[model samples]
Target: MVTPAYRMIRIKNASSIMKIIGFLYIFTIASLVGRTIAALEFNQMMGLFTPGLYQTLSFLALFLIMFVGNTGFVILLKEQVDQELLRVASFDDLTGILNRRTFVLLAKQIIAEHVKKQKHLSLVLFDIRYGGDEFAILLPEANEAESDRLVERFRLSAVQAGIPEIPATLSVSRGVVTIVPDQRTTLETLYNLCDRALYDAKGNGRNGAARTRIAL
Candidate 1:
């Protein structure tokens, strides 16, 4: 989730940079004009230079400043943009859940650790039907407040339906949940059970929760 504080910081940085850029642009233009005028006066008074020579010198200086300043500014902007994009990509924007990429990586790590310890481990994959498309439609029709309310309701249902005995950790993406079980279950059995439960939830309708059972 993008916290209010972080958003504020981003806005502040953006505003500051825009102001700096604006000032730089104005200063550059003014300097160029002033140099041209000064050169023209010196040439007229002393006959040491021509208008073309003065203009060329002024243009080269202006072009160099523009090249360096604009290049640096563009690089900085790209870095900031990339950082923001990475943060957004790592989590679900709507429900503030960990995205699928994060879930997969976490699952693999946990599974490897459990295997080393000779403990049982399981993986459960869950999906909510049409959740992505449904949210896209709802987001425009309803305001963020309303959309949040809808997401919260579904999240609450899921949490309440979670099986406490399983020692499970869950990561949610756009419309999917991946559960990593600790010490208590076999992967194949738990997956089948959870998958069936998920199907049942889907059968009943969206916005519900279901869990797979451990096979004996």
Candidate 2:
């Protein structure tokens, strides 16, 4: 969803300007032709050529062209802006991971499917408290940039963890990493166990990984 201000700004792009200019140019030509024809007939009826008739007609045509072109340009540009905003708003800029909102949506669908088929899935939630908020406060100018680097480091840590290299589905927030393990263990069992493992990792001093066992 694009904010109104963003949409307004996108409407000011060069493409929109060019489009408006093109439409107005065509409108100007058509209006001039129509005005010239009407002026000729009106002058004939009055038996005299009006001094400023052509000038007045030209001004009116210009105004109409501007009005219609500007309206159309805003409509088109707003739509484009809205589409781009949707893409940006759904993505997490830090780790290039799916944002929390999108992840939850996906989780719902996965849960429903697993319920129907009696399959298992695992979720691991862990927080990395090392270099947390203090690091951010220290580098205020480059906060997001540093956060991105930190996220990459975390991803590397995840890869190094003893878990088999299944297609790693990972989501990271400020200091939290939630890993969705491969569809091997039941969701209820996996969550409970992995949650404990996560606490164990935290207890072992912070930036580490632990896995929970499913006893089925």
Candidate 3:
């Protein structure tokens, strides 16, 4: 979740760079204008060199400073923009839950480690369609007995999680797929199995849960 504090910190970081860039701009302008006027008078009196040549060189140096500062400022701004965009893409705006893409990505990372430890992994999905809802529960380490219990509980309690966009409370069907990770196990496969289970629950009735375990 993007907490206020985190957002504020990002804002502060971006603001500080903008301030630096602004100061550099003002300083660069002031230094060049003041120096050029003085250098012109000095050259006129001395009659020994091209008018404003020294000021031009100094202006280039100052402009370089401003240019570098602006570059840094742009980089900082881009970093913040990227972070915000990633956050938005990864989380569902209405439910504040991990979006499907993010969930699959993180779940895969978990599976990679769990497989090394020979641990069981669970995947639960909630489907809210047909104005009804259901749950799908997957327990990779769970036998039929354990999955049955969890599925029953989900059937009884699973509700359609609401978002601000919708006013009416909808129902959901839950689908679960459990698997022991191996060479053939993939995120897409898991999602597909779970999604199928979700449909099964919907076929039986909305507001129900289904469980499926992949064979090793």
Candidate 4:
């Protein structure tokens, strides 16, 4: 699945510039050999080979073309490499969701933006006690009912409908934390609250959601 997408995002004939350089070298050597043979066999002087201004300009143009072509090739390779590295670093290989590190980073950024704007921001984390991994959902500009509905949808998707390439054994019973922060709430506080709520959800029956909210 990933292979086709990776193949498409690449430079076409990226090494062609190198081939062109090799061709130029061979052509120069062959031309010199032919010239030497003619001078010896036919007594031709072969004229002065000193390049004129036009010849110098043409040579520079060729060099410029090669330089540009090679630079583009390098750029394409770098882009593909960067994308692959980012994908591997940012995603969970099994679940196809954001990895824990990426989740926190993006959540922090989103919280900061929404906090400044004084907009509605909700965070829902699904603590899958049985599946060995957690699924977190961040909802910006959303209410409690909205957040609950989203989490329930995700739960059904995991438990009933199922994600592609994922086992159906993954549980969606969650510990949820929702906060409408004022001036006092911090990122650490939000994370701790969510974790506690997850514990509460697990403690209850290990297959339900618990919510704790900080008032706006």
Candidate 5:
């Protein structure tokens, strides 16, 4: 039973506690094998081997198994709950992308890193007004041409991969802004420019891309 339980834990890629318990099961098997070999070779039970001591060890082992099982279950459940909460807080329920608040928080750090590295950064915004689906992509060390190519690739892929529920192919309009970020550059400024470019795409007619370049 312990062997199978350990195998199941390994197959499931269970928590650290479960893995530790599995290792303990292995230790138990080794000890049991060593004891059996000693008993068979000696042709008599060791003087120290008493039925009462054996019973005590068995009870202690059972108590340990119960304690570890219950405690590990609670720890695993708590970890699962924490991961769920983090997912719900950090991602959009509908789109499964980073929510606006989480993006803003992480974008600040990304902007700082890019600025320090003196690298080009591109921000792309895709807004489906009718469906209320929005996506933002940040490309570090990407120039205007690279960003444009990526935007076009995404648009073409969306057009080619038709949604199962929709009768027609998906139309994606994107706004791209590429810049060599500096200390003065802010995420809000980049976002506003990208949003303006998105409107430009919409004005030119949907299913298109508009790109802007900032010197700073």
Candidate 6:
């Protein structure tokens, strides 16, 4: 039970609480072994070991078990609950993609980094639903030609996936916008330009993409 509990408390990124828990786990196991040896009358086999030491080990192990069972379980449970809440807040329920709110937040950070690095960034918007649904993709260091190729590949892949309900070829309209990000660039500006390109694709008819490049 203690071994499994120790494994449960261990996480990929170790924290202070994890370190404490690990220490407690090692101490508890050692104390348990000591207590077992004392119980089995193995004390005579070992020289210069006091009976009081076994009593102390037994008491300390019991105390540690109680402490870990109460506080450690609660901490792990709370961590799991917080992670689930974050996942719910950050992702779309149906599509399992980053929702608009998370997208905007991360997009700002990406824009700042790209501006600092003086790199190209591309944003693609398309509808994924049977009739219509919106999804956005951010491509770092992608230029106009690469973005266009990606859009065409995605369009072809969707058609090849072959949804049974659609009698005809699946049509995916995409808006592709590429820019060398600067201090003046913002997610809102990029979104607006991508939206305009999406309108252009829709205007041109289905199964096509519209490309736009921002100078600044």
Best candidate per TM-score, number?
Answer: 6
Q: Which stretches of candidate 1 lie over 4 Å from their true place?
A: 1-85, 118-193, 203-209
- Please report, in order, the local distance difference test score of every candidate based on alpha carbons: 0.50, 0.51, 0.65, 0.67, 0.77, 0.80
Q: Which tens-of-lDDT digit does each residue in 1-216 have in candidate 5?
A: 566456736766576776766666665555555556666785546444445443345455556667876887798789789889999999989878899999998888889998889888899998764675768898878888888888888888878887688788677788899987888889999999999888888788879989876654
Give the per-residue lDDT of model 1 (tens digit) for 37-57. 775775533232444544555
Model 4 residue 172 lDDT?
Answer: 58
For model 1, the run of ten residues with the poorest summed lDDT: 133-142
Off by over 4 Å in 2: 1-79, 129-193, 205-207
Candidate 3: 10-residue stretch with minimal lDDT = 1-10
Deviating ranges (above 4 Å) for candidate 5: 1-26, 29-65, 129-133, 164-166
The true-versus-predicted C-alpha distance at residue 126 of model 1, in Å, is: 5.1
RMSD list, candidates in order:
14.2, 13.6, 10.2, 10.1, 4.3, 4.0
Q: How accurate locally is residue 64 in candidate 5, as Cα lDDT from 0 to 100?
A: 67
The top-ranked prediction according to lDDT is: 6
lDDT for model 5, please. Answer: 0.77
Any idea what lDDT model 4 has?
Answer: 0.67
Report the lDDT of model 5 for residue 188: 92
**What is the lDDT ranking, best to worst?**
6, 5, 4, 3, 2, 1
Q: Which parts of model 3 are misplaced by more than 4 Å?
A: 1-82, 129-169
Error of 6 at 107 (Å): 1.2
lDDT of 4 by residue, 1-216 (tens): 233223333335434444544444444444556666766896766555544443344455456546755775686578679878999999989888899899889888888877788877676666664554666687887778888898788777767765679665655557666666566656678767777888788788766788887655
- Which pairs of residues collide in model 6? none
